[model samples]
Target: SSPPSYQNGLWGHVGKTKTPEDVDALVGPRPGLKGEGHLFDRLSKNRDAVVVLDEIEKAHPAMINEFLLGVLGNGQMQNKKTGETIDIGKSIFILTSNCFQTMITHRYRQEKDDVAALESLHSSLANTIRTWVHSGVSASGKGE
Candidate 1:
């Protein structure tokens, strides 16, 4: 078969258009960076899908809070190109991080189900946050 075609803004057309080639092409030239571009772009485009950024402890602490706020605020983001604001109103955003605790607890409280497994999950989550916060270490322990 022919090679992938990551031309224009075509990477965002996954599942709705052509085959895997289209999806592969979407992962542009810079295989490392551009490959993830489609994922971010699609997450931003979807109106209802809730994209969860797991293992967020890996991100810088300063940015982690802001990132959580943005995701929770319905994909609220700033466009560097146009210096404008954008929102994924239809999407529900959730970010899991290793630092923050209160927000996660608040979110957990909002959930309808109180199953044992769910409670255990929240407890584990809170314990993780406590560990990170008390240790005064960034997720990477890079020491700011």
Candidate 2:
């Protein structure tokens, strides 16, 4: 299925989130500033916004566990610096990755039916993501 269209939102690339401060820059308040981060700033202004995090697989495990888990699970995130909160209950989050593109492409090519191939890919990807989330490690066996 295709991703939903959003009239408002913010986009971020995880390649830039190599440190805790980077995560804060995306989701929390900027250091030494009263204003919110890019994502939170947009979210605060537009409650129905969508947030797209590209290359999510590249984010550090601490970011996934400490920051994303809170935002995703609670639909809200707090700025540690400013002691402010951003409610994301009405927002949508889209996480994109190319972690297993080669394997997915190979599997798709091996399948005869397109529907079946997509279904299989979906299931496999879901299972892999579940494993990664539970284990706090990625396919490359590197994370926390």
Candidate 3:
């Protein structure tokens, strides 16, 4: 695996998180004398970053509504302590949730039905990837 493109872009796993506030507090700007004093603020250093909110679904819906909708949609996040606007225009945010990925074989009781669902999802994903790859090839003529 190659290194991350940005300085603090690629975070493999953040363990079991419980909230989006937890997400930002862990990665966003902070208060104190100097301001913008957080791990991400220092690590990203005004560069484009990728923040991965692991186990995102574990967070309360209100936090998701407030946090993700606020920062990601607007490319800004405010420091919770001082309400200072933090710029994330060049940042890339990605989230992952194992609790959300319900394996078909695990979701259902009937073995055959589980297999069917697995096949269906796999087929759908394959088709979507194929179409996306084809479109990229058409556009760039590099994936042929």
lDDT of 2 by residue, 7-43 (tens): 7867788655787677766766455855446666667
Off by over 4 Å in 3: 1-6, 10-24, 27-44, 104-144
TM-score of every candidate relative to the true structure: 0.38, 0.79, 0.50
| Cα RMSD, each candidate | 11.7, 5.1, 12.2
Q: After superposition, how far is residue 3 of candidate 3 from its true place, in Å?
A: 17
**Tens digit of lDDT per residue, candidate 1, span 1-144?**
222223222122222313333333332223332233344355455545555444444543433333334445465654322334456566554445444466556767766476775677779867876666455446453322
Q: Candidate 2: give the clashing pairs.
A: none
Report the candidate with higher TM-score, 2 versus 3: 2
Range of the 10 consecutive residues with the lowest summed lDDT in candidate 2: 1-10
Give the C-alpha miss distance for residue 51 in model 2, angstroms: 0.7
The TM-score that candidate 2 achieves is 0.79
lDDT values for all models = 0.44, 0.72, 0.51
lDDT, model 1: 0.44
Error of 1 at 125 (Å): 3.5
Q: Write the per-residue lDDT of candidate 3 for residues 30-64, one digit (tens) a residue.
A: 34434332434443465466666555444444335
State the displacement of the C-alpha of residue 142, model 1, in Å, after optimal TM-score superposition. Answer: 5.9
